[model samples]
Each structure stands twice: as structure tokens, then as C-alpha cells.
Target: MQENERLARTFEEKRPRLHAVAHRMLGSSDEAEDAVQEAWIRLHRSDTDSVENLDGWLTTVVGRVCLDILRARSRREEFFEEHADPSAGPRSQEGADPEQAAMLADSVGLALMVVLDTLDPDERLAFVLHDTFAVPFADIASIIGRSPAATRQLASRARRRVHGASPLPDLRRQHKIVDAFLTAARNGEFERLLTLLAPDAAMRADDTAVRIGAAPLTQGARDVASVFSGGAEAARIALVDGSVGAVWQSKVRPIVVFRFTLEDGRITAIDLVAEPERLRELDVVVLDG
Candidate 1:
């Protein structure tokens, strides 16, 4: 096969993973889609003869695109919001779904897209690529143009800011936590569920979704537990990517996927990917009883 064909095949194989990385980084289905497409465009345009590790190259390109977009977004937000009234627009709500319309007010919740707004572009990219997506430090380094050690340090600092704990909970323990949450939710024991969550937990539902009356992202263990007890009709908790998480069934079908970001044995952030088009990537499978 010619070099271009070989590169094309390689890109095709890694497409899904690249899209996932872009989605998590950009937090917008539209933006992620655009970034990945841009990466592919770059790949096709560049001479592939000298390229080694096509996946790594594509990841780097996509990451850089995301960083540039993030930086531009920051500048625009500062320019428009700085001189505007504090209440010029709708106030951010706590526990609102991370989806575009809900726009939670808390700094840790979907509002965190803004807190992450504070990170330098490289720091943010390393953190998301390594911690969330489980990308290796070497690959992360390639993306950020840093050495592996430097990438490790950058990811570490990002983790600290995001409150990610070291010596992450093993998969079995993660399953146990999910089981505990499932049990508490099923029994309608709000207080017990709260005990399983950290004090400053933040909830995020996909803010860009158009689903009518979708449940809001609930922040804090206590508030989330309350929402679970009051709102959940039936829930199925399962392991996805070695973590304990649950999906809510609305009208006899799985409608929402919930992923918990844990720190020090308590849930720190709850990310709900509510966009129907993006549900498959979230791994919202219905585990049989």
C-alpha cells in the first residue's frame, strides 16, 4: 500500500478513540466533531512518509486544536463578561445538568469547564488526556510538546487542581462503591447515599442537549443523594473504564449515563452525558440482573 493509504487506514482505526478524547476535552459535541475533523484534514495534508506512530501524531494535532480553541474561548468570555452586569444574563444554577441550557453555577460542576478555564493550555490538555482518558504520559508529552517527566508533572498538577487522588481506587473497590450507591438508591436511603459522596461533589449534565425536562446535574453528595431518592424510578449501576457509575432509566429505557469522579473515597464530580447522540460513547450499557 502507498504511504497515504497506509496513513488513511491508521486514521480510520483510531477514529473513535480520537473523537472521545476530543469530546471530553472540548465538552461540546459540535466542537469535538470539528476538532477531530480538523485533525484528519491535517493528517491528509501532511506528508506521511516520515511520520512514526500515526495515532500519537493525530492525538497531538487534535489536542493542539482543542487548546487553541479553549484559549480563544477564554479571551472572548473575559472580553464580554468582564464589563457586563453580574446578572446581565441568567444566573448559573447549582446541580443543573452540564448540558448547555442547564449551566450549573458551581465552580466544580459543569461550571468546572470554566474552572478548567484557569489552567494553562498545556496543563489542561495533559490532565484531560492522561487522567480522564488514561492516555500514557509519553503520548501526552507528544501532544503537549513536553518531555514525559514534564508531562507527568503537568498531569499531576492538573489532577491536584481537579482534586483527583493518587493511588486511584482499584476496579474492584470502584465496583463496590457503585454497588453501595446502587443499593442506597434502590432502597431510597438518602442519608446513607450521602455518606458515600464527598462534601464538595459537583454534578454536570450535558448542557447542550435539547431533551425536555431531563433531570438536572445534582451537586454535593447530600444534594445528589436527595435527587436520586426523589427522582430516580429505577437505576442500574455498572463498571465503565474501571469506575463505579450508574445509569437512570426513564420510561423503561436507559436515558442518562452518570460517571462519578471520586476523590478520597467520595464523589467529587458527577458528569452526566445526556446528549442522546453521544450516549454510546459514554458506555451506557444495561447490565442484566
Candidate 2:
């Protein structure tokens, strides 16, 4: 009984931080509360005698629970998008309360939440745990099933997207570069593609895109150009998240989004995102041809 009492007291002390982690991850207070309760239940059932770091264990538990919830939510949204009738109007939010959402958004900074919504689940987890909460990458790696180096890369990518690592180039110039690159790729003009890319250019794809056959990482101008050469015939120029980029649509819904980073009139990086959840969060406005 004494041991149990100590455990209970310890859990209550940790509850606030656990709830904060879940709230940032889920962006829903109710869901965050549920996650915290689940963590408590799990802690009660598990043997902690051998656990050297109870705080780390509880944090990992909450992170995993939130990750599962995000994945399930993504799957459900994809299913609804694939099958729901257009005439039914937009899908309802179900349990979402607008007032509560707004309050949470305000507390978390609405802009940050908007950017967080655009990241893939793993990226979001890495960014929130490591960057927001100062959790070690090694601990996060165990939760996400990735090497510490790979986990750091995820957080870095998310940070760039969230904070705009550098000043954005002029919109008109960016559009022209994107347009020329698309034209070159469609015509198999490999030379033109190379001219528009920096010598050390790189391309990366999210897990969803990689699962569908995209290389996880392509480096060097030649290699990156080769990947796009004779491809992107169906891609169209668009403004993705207020920056000039490209979007590939299937029956009016975006299937793939290409986010570019330009420097000195050359493309330095390209990010191919196809995760349905992330795609839905992007503000894509297809330009009129």
C-alpha cells in the first residue's frame, strides 16, 4: 500500500507536464486529457521496480499514445475524403467545440499550430518532443523507431518549415523558376533542369511518398535532376503555404505537393509531401494556366 501511494503521488506531480505534451501534440484539450488518463492507467498496470527514469517512461508513454491517435485520425480523414459524397458538404468536426479549439489555439499560438498541422506525424512528434519540450533525441528515437541522427533530421526539417529558416525569395522569381523546372522535367530536358538547380541540391520525401516509390533522399544536382527528368507531366504550378511551389492533383484533390527552397535563382532543396493529413493542411491555390 505504501508503494502504491508513492506511485500515485508521483504520477499526480507529473500530470501537468504530461498533459501539456499531449495537448501540443493533439491540439485538442479533450483528447489530451484522455491521453493523460490513459498514461495513468498504463503506469498503474506496469511494474516500475526496474524503471530507472519514471519521468522519461511516462513521457514516452504519452508520446506513443498521441502518435497512435494522430495516425488513426489521418487514416479516417483519408477514408472519408476517398469515399464521402461531395453533395454531403464538408465533413463535420464531430466532437470539436469551436470555442475550446479557439482557446487552445490562442494558448498554443495559432500560427504555430497551423504550421504544426502541416507536418507528418513523425516529424510533428520529433519537433514537439525535441524542440518544444527539450526531450533528448535518443529518447524520442526509441519512441519513433528511428536512429537518433534520423530523429534529429526530422526535427530540423520541421523547424525549417515552421520558422522559415531563411528569408523567402521574391514570389514572381520563385514562380518563374518553378515553371521553368516543370517545363524542363516534362520535356526530358535534363540540361535545363540542371541549370536551375544548385550544384549541391537535394530532394527529400516523406514516408508516405517513399512508400509509393519516391527515394527518401536524393542529393546532388545531377541526381536530383535525373529523378525529375521525364516526370511531373501532370504537375501544375501553385502557391503552397504562401510560397510558390507545385502541386499534383487527382480529380481536383491534391495527391502530391512539391515544396521548393530557392537561393540566388537556383533551387537548393525540394520536399515531396504526399501524406494525406499534411496535404489537407497545406494552403494550395492552383494557378490558372
Best by TM-score: 2
- Candidate 1, 104-216: lDDT as tens digits: 11211233454464577788888888877777898878766789999999988987876743333454455567667767777888888888888877777776322545455
> Each model's C-alpha lDDT?
0.65, 0.83
Off by over 4 Å in 2: 94-99, 165-289
Off by over 4 Å in 1: 1-6, 85-87, 91-120, 134-150, 164-289
The Cα error of candidate 1 at residue 175, in Å, is 22
Looking at candidate 2, the ten consecutive residues that score lowest on lDDT are 86-95
TM-score of each: 0.47, 0.56
Cα lDDT of candidate 1 equals 0.65
- Location of the lowest summed lDDT over 10 successive residues in candidate 1: 100-109
